[model samples]
Target: MDSYICQFPGCFKQYKNRCNLKRHEEAFHTENKKFQCVHCKKILSSKQNLKEHEFIHTNQTPYVCREPGCGLRFRHGSQHSAHKRIHVAIKNIVNRSSVVSFKLSNIEEDIEEEINPKDMMDFTLPLIKRSQDYILPVI
Candidate 1:
């Protein structure tokens, strides 16, 4: 099989197909951003990127978690997936038998900030709290 390597300096990306190589160059190397956001007028490289960017102005969060009592919505699938892990960790903690193990040394810093529930009345986003901060039932 023939490989198409990108000629861009410092970019050693290789593709099996010729069209894929061209797409990579157009998307990353070239400044030919033809697609523009209708609301913000921000130029994007591709149609998909432009559509995703437009969601910010439209306030359309297509990715929603169906977890009971938590209907949090996100603009991206990655954000929604990360949010779902919180629910999984909470459930594991409650059950006690199925705790997910991880190295504490690997953690760099806390990604969440302490927030009062009363202050979050206007927002749909959940109040992220540390595991130790929660008052779990005595098991």
Candidate 2:
């Protein structure tokens, strides 16, 4: 009997045939996830989905934008990166202009001082509302 091995790193489980190995790979290594959330009991389709779902239960936003005044936080890295791109575009526009080149740190400090927690809360409420409109219905 030939042993078929899983090629995934750290996954050394072997199978007796190619079909069994394929089944094992599909069941374990594939993006398909079978785990259910203990809190909401929501069935996430993948590990990444589960991670993002878990964040919905917490108030913490781990991915924070570091572009000075833009203290916006995101639950997902992709969302944060998308937001950063906006800043990059703005910086490029400013660099090309003949106007006084303003340092983001200096501008950010002034903006940060004016922005309060209530202001942030007000800004986020609409985003939360908009996000709800796009949420996929639970299957």
Colliding pairs, model 1: none
Runs in model 2 deviating more than 4 A are 1-31, 99-139
Instruction: Report the Cα lDDT for candidate 1.
Output: 0.75
For residues 1-139, could you state the per-residue lDDT of candidate 1 as single tens digits? Answer: 8999999999999987897688678878999989987777788887766776788898899989999889999986658988999999988776653232232222423523555578778777657675543335534
TM-score of each: 0.46, 0.46
- Weakest ten-residue segment in model 2 by summed lDDT: 130-139
- How well does candidate 2 score on lDDT at residue 66? 91
